[model samples]
Target: MTNIQVLDNPTMHNLLINLSKEESFTFREIIEHTLESFSVNGERQYQPPPSIVNRPNGQNTLFRPFTSDTCIGTKITVESGPDGQGRKSPPHGVIVLTDSKGNPTGLLSSNEITGYRTSMNAFRFLGERMWIIL
Candidate 1:
């Protein structure tokens, strides 16, 4: 099945709809884990303060004009899988986070969001079939 066909079919469309939801939830989880894993110690902490407040020379004014937040952006790609014609296809993508300077902070190529979405869709479908709606 081709990616274009996957986007065209109604069943696939529904699956994709749920897949997107799952991917979003999974991506949030991944970000939470990453944030939990991060630490600020010694130079790392002082290197870039979470927020910077500065006062202009000759002006008795304090201002916090710089702040930063972090998140992981996920993107998916499909390359003619194994058979070359996409008779059987697979997905490839990665997750990356940008630093305050807009540079890549980490490279996570697990395709975890895709796998989570696929598995959740199939599991839900099967559970419905088995009347185990949990």
Candidate 2:
């Protein structure tokens, strides 16, 4: 049984911060893990490109879907103003992780996950390239 956990922004931020400080995984490990997750036996991973729609209030919303061997999810992000001239809010989305039976075994919020993952990737890139010298 999958237990649903609803985490607000503050809680999510705190959790991510804690994980970042831990630095348990090395940079190379992160890169390897990400690449491995993209494929399973031998199939290319696929994800839907983001689509944007303009709202009546001059705002724009983006929708995207991604899938891997273990997870499937859709993300919707709201941006204020037609030209992105107004305040933009973080993405509010859901991620569903499935089991071998194709049943959802876990649900997670995407906003903080995106933020945390992006930061981790950046760190990984730096760590991977930092050793290169001119």
Candidate 3:
């Protein structure tokens, strides 16, 4: 049993904002971090394919595990289908962070991070091909 610091949406957002200010983080840092992971000379870690489970309540849960040299963790998200009125439920998730020794450290809400990562990837792709588009 490991003690995990669970961070909710507001807390996660505040932490990210604080961190960005303290470290002067920018979108370029996101792209660099992603590129570094896939570099030819960088150490590649094993990331098993995500597993999805469909519940009886019309909700699907996805569990994705990833590993790096310093840490490993899993992201679990639940997607609820449309309701009786055809209104879709917003997806929610948490990401568990663990140290190299497999000790759980923190559990963060994944909504913000997911959106940020997605947008960053899209920006990276477009930035790399801006000349062709222009």
Candidate 4:
């Protein structure tokens, strides 16, 4: 077993803000680096199996395991339909990050990371294409 830091959304956001200022950095560099992994020559140490997507009780769940040169992690999430009256939304799953030694390093909120990655990817893709149209 490896030591792991489990941080909630607020803690994670606060830490990231401080780190951004301290390093004088934004996520642009990180996102750009990640985008590089999508190119023609990017390497995958191991291929990913087909993801699992099932909807029992009319709810959605997706479980995916992926690897790269820097890390390996899994994201498991569930969506219990849309927002409604007087109902608390279900707590989604987590993104579990493990190191090269195969020991768990961190467990982060799935929603937070997923939202950020999705939004960034959309913007980067659109931004690149929009420049061409102008």
Candidate 5:
């Protein structure tokens, strides 16, 4: 992942915006000067598979995984917007299960993953402070 990737999604951007609002720091600033540095954008390029596997004058088989369980994997979640918000619209965020190569083997909303990551970071920060006190 790269800075380019983090700033790409609106939800993640919104989350970062919220973080900036609460933490009083820009997302870019945090990414540039943070204890836990991570690439925002991670990409997996497509590779065409061998033709012989198809048989009978087999053409090139592109093993590109798109947005589906058959291509990617199962979508575990699908919700209509955030709670306390009106209007039934497309869900926000997506949970994607990736393979060992980081290719998206599955897709879901980012809600749970985002929450867990944020919470764990918070816990780690507080825990470290508590340890210092003790």
Candidate 6:
């Protein structure tokens, strides 16, 4: 069994911020990975529709499973209705990653990364358009 590295919100936030720097090696690798995912060979990456479950307490849980050449994992997020005071809670989730051999490798807090990941697509799109305009 592989040792699982658990990264909470602060750690995950810091890691993502560092990795997102313009000069970071990991950021470049992430771009390469994103581009590869659109390639013919990488088209086989699997991501199925998420499973949603409504809890008795009015919270909905979503499990989104995906697999890549290197790892398989699921991101579980909970969506809660507004409280009695009419204030909605912030979205929160966790990502569980396992190696190709099925060993649990890491568990990451998805709160920050979820937004970061979403913004990356927009950034990538703008970057491509900028090159075209130039």
The lDDT leader among the candidates is 6
Off by over 4 Å in 6: 20-46
lDDT of 4 at 51: 68
- Each model's total of backbone clashes: 0, 0, 0, 0, 14, 0
The regions of model 5 sitting more than 4 angstroms off are: 1-91, 97-104
Question: RMSD in Å for candidate 3, one decimal?
Answer: 3.6
lDDT score for candidate 3 against the true structure:
0.78
Q: Give each model a TM-score.
A: 0.31, 0.62, 0.73, 0.67, 0.32, 0.78
Report model 5's TM-score to 2 decimal places. 0.32
Error of 4 at 111 (Å): 1.6
Q: How accurate is candidate 2 locally (lDDT)?
A: 0.63
TM-score of 6: 0.78
Residues 1-134 of candidate 6 have per-residue lDDT tens digits of 44999999999778878764665446655856854774435554465667999977678889988777788888999889779987779878999999987789999999987777677767777888999999
Candidates' C-alpha lDDT: 0.43, 0.63, 0.78, 0.68, 0.41, 0.79
Query: lDDT score of model 4?
Result: 0.68
Per-residue accuracy of model 1 over 1-134 as CA lDDT, tens digit each? 12111122344345545656668567555644443454332323322323322333221222112123543233323333345453644544444445555565544443454555556556655757889644
Tell me how far the alpha carbon of residue 60 in candidate 5 is from the true structure, in angstroms, after superposition. 38
Per-candidate alpha-carbon RMSD to the true structure:
18.1, 4.3, 3.6, 4.1, 16.5, 3.0
Top candidate (TM-score)? 6
Query: Which residue pairs overlap in candidate 6's backbone?
Result: none
Off by over 4 Å in 4: 16-25, 38-40, 81-91, 125-134
